[model samples]
Target: MHAPPSPLEAERSDGGSGSVRIGVLVPLTRPGWVEAGHHLLAGIELAGREVNDTGGIAGRPLELVVRDTAADPRKAAAAVDELARLGVAALAGEYHSVVARAAAARADALGLPFLCSSAVLDALTEQPTEWVARLSPPQSRGWRVYADFLLGAGHSRIAVAAQPSIYWASGTRVVRDHLAPRGGTVIELDMNALTPAAVCDALVDHRATALLLLVGHPEPAVSIVKAVRRDQRLAEVMMGAPAGQPEFAAWATSLGDDGAGIPFLRYLPERLGPLGARVERALRERLAGAPSFVAFEGYDTITVLADVLRSHGTDRARTAESWPRVAVQGSRGRIEFSRTPGISVWQWTGTPVHVVDRDPAEPGRFRILHAG
Candidate 1:
């Protein structure tokens, strides 16, 4: 693969004409969280439209060259290659951590600037690189907060219904490491071998007071929740999904009240500020329903990228260099990027973190249990 064009070459490549195109990587198809993709895309598209409506980047239209990753790392890497070849000024939008990692690696290798929209994995790149930056809080930070929530809720004996994946593994490790020092024990129930009934049985055997769903939605996650809720032996066991699976509507549609009261991590404040409230209204109309934190993350990604592109121009190298200087107001808060310890990308440390769950009395309403 050819290395990305230098600032001068990139400036000339566009011929100082036409739309300012950004390569958008999102999972819009199956095997990829489709609902999450829809919300993400909605936020991105809304922001892109707003940018163009307000004169766009330096009087040129802002266009998004979208590619569906389908939650596959290989597919994401290929998409990065294709987008780079297509001469996109920068890359944006991805919801899955593993897939985003693959894209970030490829973008770094080819010297393309990638403003990751979601994907909270701490090590986005093998080593630090200016080519990549992220909007989501890292798994370590989010899961550590989750562990604290577990401990504060008086559930020291925790069990994780985990699948085999790097993202899940990292989350499990973060929770384990955080809880270990505080006298909390985390039992890993491998989903590969255990059925939903078997998971409940393991909870009973382990005497775990809380069972976290480290698996995917609708299949093992939904099934495990149903099984645990139905099994009288595990009725008192608190259920959780630290990865924010329950933030989407599909979780409620699939499990209803069974899905309610299951706390999960969310990257949103308890109340939306002025900007957040305005974006929330727009996104709700665009989505025809309540928007998840993923949607806000998507909006913020475009918001930040648009700011950079406007101030720094669309040169790939220049865009990457401008990460640390970024200071744009997003729906969530004052968005800024800085080098966070152990994180390889320019991270927005100010992103709000909340532990929330759907109210059992009203499944549509969310209740914030904790904030960090």
Candidate 2:
């Protein structure tokens, strides 16, 4: 019941004395997510630098009071309190849905504006609050997109490999809910209960044409992929995952050849327009690696936050009040929100979903298979 620990350092340019500070929440040293946190932090920092270089918001520079949630929900909620206490104009940046849920609750209670960068649990947006907004589409909508894509690809008998996390659970539930009634058969496999060999057995037994993975962590998914790739019978069977999109590099690096030809849902396009291309290049140069979907999420989240702070000044209430109407152009598309049912309060609607498949011809390269 102690408050979440504050960031050791505030990231900003020189002359931050008059800068506008915003709370940036990310899992910096969380178990199994250190690399992801670095990617997110890089994106947010890139956005902050861009805004400052362009004269900042209302002629004042932007600074981030970053807080590490360590992938803990309680800590995330406490971080919200600490951020609000620090007098930030708004809150932004998140990678874990569980943390996002807790942070959303705290933001609602404090009447502060919070923009989720990349957490996609459907219920995060379903909460009754006016201050919470998300840059990513909720899983309720995104999963359906996955389901439709699978069914349209002529995949009828599908097997789902799932972990026990709520994020994975939500994904399995949506695929089952959407695909079952469409004459598609779904078989669920618990990642903990089933060995890679046992999962392969089930796929062969069920004659499943495709496997839908709900496990978020890369190691489990990697094990399953490695096992299936060695089986000749399962070689032709398609494998897809909603959770794979964000941590694809980790999975690919581990699974190697097994990772190729696997399909996953991504939030942004592989290709970009002029503005997006510039941002993507900047992020790649800054991170010294390929840009992730969450990087775009981080960049877009802060860009929208800068716009809100610029127009509404540093008043949290006015920023929350103005959230519903503010339409800022993001790296992907126009970032806007409305009070839509079955979504979080002030959640952005019509967030695009794209299916990218790891190329078999060229390892580690993802080719856009479908766009929606």
Candidate 3:
């Protein structure tokens, strides 16, 4: 178990730490975002409940302030500003990477210590201010992890299909980096330039050993699977990270046994530490009728935030200092942040990797291809 910091050590102030106040900003209507957000909130609630159950942080109950960004960047900035004016000790979240930029800016202006839970895009934290720290692994890290997994799997050729979004552009270079040293080749495709049918056509021509998909939205991910089906090449391809959204659930029907066969490289699972149990229990209990990567991620993100509150005596200064130590055992294993630029932990450490086999008729609906 990781040890908590001592009082003197915990006194470091990134922002004036007083009563622990957290302002949460998320897009409440981004289809899968809300359900995922609920889990995150649940995690926060659970942590708060524990602290209050134990007698509040520093003898004061934590005040959780929330606002909906509606997945809009302008609204996100405004929401953070509103939260800052309300004088939150620290700020946590804005789900979309684009929205996070605005919220993060507001936090910086206030000199408030802010930690972003998701927003894995590289540019999200590129130019750090005194107020920001990202809890999610950077986009660059995600790609490198992909490279490692594929290269280690003995695949020498890979093809890339990325969602047409700014987030994916930031780490596009990592694909080459991962392939560089190993003599593997990477082929790239743009979602905007090609329809699912077009994408499927391109994949057929590549004939690469594996597929490196950086799709963020579920609709496209599902479409890609369907598009590929025309050629009946489900087994010929694989997937990496950014495949955890609730939208992927629809693909299970079309791919059937093949859908369950998709490989995943992502964060959260039992290895991240306390998060695995946290997510499994939350997903199984509250979201019993559902399955999603975002559900687990959202839950773990809020759970970590709540724990941060309890760590620093519920005081703002302590809360700010506690950001660095706040760790969540996500579905993938323990997730933490680095103060360094272009560096974040993405390895599963001691977690399990689950690949969804699209083939429903298969007994191995999911398998642990790698166990940390």
Candidate 4:
């Protein structure tokens, strides 16, 4: 088979006239989560189409210049630079947190307004800057809620099967820190040095009631689930994935019944409002499946950016300046930005956080276990 297209070779434009351009960064190839990227792009494209249908940002059609980051921080940073030079009015979209952080830093240095779609790392930038804002709830907020769920479920001794990365490391710290103060204990199972079977052994040795899959999808995550599920000792052990590995259909297709009942964090309201419902139906048709929260985030990124471009014009500085003034109805809820403590960028504090899992009897359907 031919090698996947390079980031530059894969770049393309989607929707609207070329008069006004928005840079779209997504992980559309391997090493990146291609499935998540597709869902994200669908939402962005749908919103862009709708914006054009409604009059196209003050009659100047909003164009999207897309680039594939391939889950690489360096690639994403370079894409930000190239998009900035291309005269894009702003930058948007990135699923991986580390990649988003790199892109955010570059955008800030260059003064390009970036509305990050789905990377939830608490620190998207090393220092505060007005040029970057985020649509997803920070990792600390979501993962802390997840830790609370673990406590409520009576799991005090928890184990995390984690891969080495800044994102995974931060998540581990969040779970550990949040749990330690509340009579909960966390055990770490390093995936770098352990096999699936070894992970099962570690879980049993630690007497961990819950095993959180903090690794990548379909490789160690899938293998660990299988190994643990088959091990009689782990039968009573609960499995969780707060980073949302099982949110996509592939997780079901790969693990099926084995994948069900593993709780994960998602940033969606318990119920969709009128705008959310309308967008859901459209996104469903576009994706040919239920859209993940990431997709809604992508759609909302465009929705907010479109609003800013319309009111603030296409000037980069003007777009960055309008973050605090934003109050648009997104697919999830009323989108607004503010300076949240410990977070470096303009944050939408209202993005809903939910703990959900696939039903054991019906792997295709999700059951909301807890909300935060």
Candidate 5:
């Protein structure tokens, strides 16, 4: 979401008068990042359409050079270097914070002003390279929303179940800080691997009235939900991150009523403005009907980078100047950057938390239980 990804690319005007080559490192193999990459490419192509229709960057057609990292940090780092070796004027990369960080560090070392799609981990911004920027808010943002929502809803005690991984760990910290001032105490459950029942047991042991599931994938989350629902824990409500992706609903269709009213933190708003509309339409055409987080992330990442070229910096000196000023309106509501550590926003600025209960037999989905 950040307009200029310090972790992504730096540009050099081609000797020829009118062309620029941009490099993109995609999470082409991993299921989540792969979906993210596809939508991102689709978003770029759509932007490419607009640029071609007018003129091109500096008058020459813009060329997009892409590579697949398969979600591996080392591979992503290598791919970024390779793209730089091949000589791209600008660059953009995947949404995973760890992978994006590796890529960003390399870009910074090379003096490449890399653009990251959505990683928001605080470490990414810690070194202050000025080359990297993120568009997503941090876990603090999400925790703020959830804590406010919880206090407003009148829940006195809450427990958050999150992975010990750096990304989720950050989210947990945010949740705790927000809940402390109020009469609420957030118990952290660190688990190597857990089944649905184990999750329920943790929640039960803590005697939590609510649970915030902060994770980057949907499978473990799906398992947790099943156990909760199977046991019929009627007192608790569940909220989670968009990291579960829309596909999570498909996989957990069996949860029926329990999955009903799960909240998902979505990036794209329903009504996209002019530019946002075009990106949305292109994404729908490309995605068919898959309402995954990848589509929004992809659209936002590419659009932000393209906007940086058009409205902000194309050269490093200009980039440093323009990055702070650039903002892109796309499928993701006002895609931009945040000073965080991961390529994700839900970990920071809290998600809207949608319930995931969608009936497989029916085409529609379970309604939103709560907005925040």
Candidate 6:
């Protein structure tokens, strides 16, 4: 069996001699994301333990300096400064776009390498800095992928509901732009300004075949689905959301049968590899529940960091320079980074995203519609 994680003390600070410290930034107590933070931390700790057990980076054990972002931008920025003060070699693990943007700025100012674990905001990468990189695809590309799925599914008239945040707004624009040329009608709806009933009215007026949600939370997404299901005219309309992927349970429980046909993006595979299967089993047995995609992201972040440190040692400059060149076969898929214009620098362009939906026959299970 693999070894358990190091003591809590090790997570707070460096514990042993010859240990390379990597700062972990996660939201543990955010208003709606406490559970998400825990899952991400679980995956990070698991990978760190495995790295340490397998002779660490050049025989130096990997130490994670865990810090809670709390879904606050200022807190995330402060945490980066704090972790740097604690002598961490690199910064990793942030799920929120706002927090990731703040952490990335702080890490850049501190001259520390920061690898964003799951934040997808394009602005996070748009900043000109070699110190920042992301494991998730830009929201624009992710939205485009979803748009392609809609077109492939014969959804010509799609209603777009998006969060006010640029993270969602930019992606919404991509979807509209992609569909306009294909003779597909995209009616934009303000998620904050319009009630679910109003959105439903708009969808019906437009004769929309699908509703695309680009949001950061599950509330409005669920509310809209519940609203859509309540109307017979909208019953035939497909409701798809990218935000629901992270909070599948919340969506499923809140909407029940209403969530069956809806599709959302997620990174985890229905079936795991041998290593991933073992990790999942161990996490499930320990946590008394199944793991989520955040867990997989956390695991892979550490794995990539370990690989980078292994090849480049602890020199911050060399490590940052080598980030674009670093590649590892992570749990999700081939983990690699490349600089793309309009995307972020050193961003992981190969994130495995699949459109998943709840199976009507088996409510607990999911059905993958398309892999991108």
lDDT of 3 by residue, 122-228 (tens): 66534555457665556566556656667777877676788665766655577687678889887888876888877766777777666656674455766776566
Q: Is candidate 3 or candidate 5 better by TM-score?
A: 5
Question: Least lDDT summed over 10 consecutive residues: which range in candidate 1?
Answer: 1-10
Encode model 5's per-residue lDDT on 316-372: one tens digit a residue.
556645556655565645444443444321122321233233443453554333344
lDDT of each: 0.90, 0.80, 0.58, 0.91, 0.58, 0.79
Candidate 1 residue-wise lDDT at 362:
96
lDDT of 4 by residue, 182-225 (tens): 99999988888999999989988899999999999989888899
Off by over 4 Å in 4: 1-18
Q: Write the per-residue lDDT of candidate 2 for residues 1-372, one digit (tens) a residue.
A: 331432313344464577788898888874637667778888888888788879988888777888888889888898899989888889998888888988998899898899888888878844577888888888878788888888888998989988788888888888888988899888988888989899999999999999977775566777788788898989779988776543447766777777788787888865677878998899889878787888888989888988888887888888888878889988888878887677766788857788877788986677887776
Clashing pairs in 1: none
Q: How do the predictions measure up, each by TM-score?
A: 0.95, 0.93, 0.76, 0.96, 0.78, 0.90
Distance from true position, residue 146, model 6, in Å? 0.6
Candidate 6 to truth, TM: 0.90
Candidate 1 CA-lDDT value: 0.90
**Regions of model 1 farther than 4 Å from truth:** 1-17
**lDDT at 135, model 5:** 50
**lDDT at position 196, candidate 4:** 94
Count of clashing residue pairs in every prediction: 0, 2, 33, 0, 50, 0
Error of 6 at 273 (Å): 3.0
RMSD per candidate (Å) reads: 4.5, 2.7, 7.5, 3.0, 5.9, 3.7
Off by over 4 Å in 2: 1-17, 245-247
Query: Candidate 3 regions off by >4 Å?
Result: 1-20, 233-235, 239-243, 246-258, 269-279, 289-318, 321-338, 341-365
